[model samples]
Target chain A: MKKLFTGVCVAAALSLSGQAALADVLDDIAERGVLRVGVKADYPPYGYLDEAGNIVGIEPALAQDVADLLGVELELIPVVSSNRMQFLEQGRIDLMIATMTDRNDRREVVQIVDPNYYSSGTNILAPTAAGLTEWEQLDGLPVCGIQGAFYNRKTEEEFGAEIVAFTGTAEALAALQQGTCVAFVYDDSFLISRLSEPEWADYEMPLQTIDDAPWGLAVALGEDRFAELMSGMIVNWHLSGRILALETEYGVDNTPFAERMHQLFLDINPSIER
Target chain B: MDGIEAWFLDLYHTTGINLTIVYDAFDRERFLWGLLNTVILSVICLVFSVIIGIIGAWLLGARHAIPRRIVQAYVQFFRNTPPLVQMYFFFFALGPMFMTTVERHVGQMVFVSETPLLTSFHWAVISLSFFAGAFNVEIFRSGIEAVPRSTIEAAEALGMSRWQIYRDVILPLAFRICLPALNNNLVNLVKTTTLAYAIAVPELLYMSNQIWSDSVNVPEMMTVLLFVYVGLVAILVFAMQRWERAMKLPGFGR
Candidate 1:
């Protein structure tokens, strides 16, 4: 009786292990009726908690819509800027909709989807009272920034600017507000949004755009089926005019630059009829 | 005369802003605000940790075997686990329970907002204090035990009350002996406060991170950040060393 029981237990354990190995995220999400998405909740106009304390933003909204189309509920997992990819690789999230730039380095680790919706350039935000009209005016002056942002290398190599980097946007803002740096370098859209705020009326982005960088979402490599599904969704959304509708809804349509992005998306995916 | 000099001059002519911008950005008002928040967090953690440490040490140092063993288990458990894990458990797992309890009693009395009285900052302080206190309890307990039993006996024979014995005899000597360990613990506590950034308490590191993400000039920003943190920690170490030296007495043999 003991021998039979031991044999049964070993067989059962082996079967369970085999089943666990075969489990795919796409299948699991489908069965669970929820798409677990990782997003940076601190970033505004992207993924942030609304006034009502609900997670509401562009990426999260898009995630929710995607989940809805898939007939699944949306489960948003708040991720910091640094750890979003780690979360994706570790299976902590099914998809990442954070403002992750599609870089050649990152492409080695994760598969990138087509139809990058957002295009932004780096710019300098300085105090209006600083008399700084150009980037050159920031020479010999400290510039505040975030730690993991890509511009750190370029800023140092190209401009010879003294950079004071913080870990997040809020800290950098506080530093900028406190005059820790003469100027701040960040994405143009973020700079524009923050500068437009009543509290930051004193600050202005005086320099021209530095680089044309496009942003995209990333999924784990080898998940071709899931990637295809995501691409198909984007194509379908573009075709149905839903992408533009979402852009308008999120207030991205208000900017002439973003309107150009909308046209760019249409240009790339001509099959997107609307 | 060198290529580097020309490059530097060209870059300076191109990217450098006016000094007024630096002055405006690093204004005193905002620094004071950040400093105020930092000091408040430190003070709250210090007081709460000391109190918890004393209570925990007393419990562990009790004559009874069972209670002492239980306290030892607690000390070992908290000490063994990472403070970050503890913070997460407190904030995510146990936070709901605490919030519910508070909401039942005081949520109605206070204005209803999204976040309750058990704010993220409060949770950060509470978690850090308890985490630090657990280690402090062991330090204090060892110091208490190191106090010669004869000294306590003499105090007792002289008709001193329990409180008097603890206050006049045990505590002073124990504190003197534990000063070095306690100083180390205090420094650890200050550094550990950086973990509060994880829960979005807007501490120094978090502030820097936010700034970097928004600004994108990470290398320059991080260099400044490294200096700031190193400078802060160095100052703390220097101050503590001075304190330890001042407290030392040649005859006492501490």
Candidate 2:
């Protein structure tokens, strides 16, 4: 048991950049000829399963870009909130495009690429009739939230929400539908998509979103080449308005974050147009 | 406690391993609450399960065939199914059936009137109790059966009623024999309380997850969680062993 715990600790917190024994993960992926990218197959528009049982979404498409750039076959590994970081750390996936909010602490675990590819803010999906216009309305009320979310504590502390965290978005959504909570606090991107769904017709994202966190796609720590390559790709995405185009294709509104990023990048290279 | 907190805070600066539950106010408060909830859940389940076990064991000897069959079926049902699934079933499937819609007062759009008969904590108690109770009933039945038939016949011949003989003669002897097995099962019940974390019970495991998610100190928080559970189980086992020694039956199996 002691040996196992030690191994787990090492696996979770190992600084491969400082280790002499570990090889460059970019070389490993190239040698294997398979760029295994972790994407959220459950989070639609970002990454979700199609009716044909194939994984496809904006993130998966972005993964395809990485694979194409590397001249490797794209392999999309479905990841959720709990396991995405671990999967990248354990060498199960070459890149992680799961909707992980970039945070300082997470930078210690996985090498998050600079210029985050996407951004989302926190909001609440409440029944339209619930009259939950203000964050203060959630005081002493149960609000469903996905486990591992950074905003769970903020919602509970600042808004006085009794955050009932579930292991996954599916479970949180189920609890919300069951009236186990007054509202479901999550990414506005996810909540907005849910509103578009016919099954969630009664529910609406009632509060103005707050805590605008950028989602950083990550690679294993110490993969400097992979990290540098991803940074360039993200810049190109912003420069070319690829993300804005993907949003339109996936039925997501062109968020201010995306538009602003495009304008910022276009300034750097004004001659380039998409 | 302040000194201890300072020590942990210093440890973070030196080693880069943050045990926030020790030093941070928010994390410590919630983690401690989680620990308390786990203890309460386990104890409630333990006491209620034992009661259910004793009643079910007593019913096994009922004169009517129906009650005995019902007990047998219940034992099988709970024993065969996974405890986790049983919890989900109780919370999601069975809980809705028992919900009573309340009248939302004085005007608003549709809001929460869906108050279920049992809360998540209550459902966890019920599910865990029934799961452990199945094993307890079987353990108790074997203990009761081990009480020599001659002793029971002696009570019957003495014109002692069945309930009287069960309460006076059989239970005392059976309980002595049941202690070791009961002790093991109770320990298991305590460990199983961690499952309550899945349903947002604010138990130790759940709170630890919250801490790690926020603090990004997975190894530190996990190591702490390990020691806490080990400590809890150790106390339980120590007490149960002491009880076993105290309740040893004279001239019975050593």
What DockQ do you compute for every candidate structure? 0.05, 0.23
Considering the two chains of model 2, state its CAPRI-style docking category: incorrect
> Which runs of model 2 end up more than 4 angstroms from their true locations?
A1-43, A46-118, A215-274, B102-112
Q: What's the CA error at residue A8 for candidate 1, in Å?
A: 68
How close to the true structure is residue B68 of candidate 1, measured as C-alpha lDDT? 84
> Mind giving the per-residue lDDT tens digits that candidate 2 earns over A1-274?
3443344334324433334355687677778999999999888878888999999989999999889877899999999999999999998998999999999999999999877889999888987768778887787788889888889999988878888898888878877777777789888988867876899988778776787889999999988766766777787788889999998998777777899889987876698864
Q: Number of clashing pairs, model 1?
A: 44
Which residue pairs collide in model 2, if any?
none
For residue B249, what is the lDDT in candidate 2? 66
- Among all windows of 10 consecutive residues in model 2 chain B, the one with the lowest summed lDDT is B103-112
In order of appearance, the predictions have TM-scores of 0.49, 0.74
> Would candidate 1 be rated incorrect, acceptable, medium or high by CAPRI criteria?
incorrect
Candidate achieving the largest TM-score: 2
Candidate 1, B93-171: lDDT as tens digits: 5654543211111112321112233645778898888888988898888788889999899999999987787778887
Candidate with maximal lDDT: 2
Cα shift from native, residue B42, model 1 (Å): 2.4
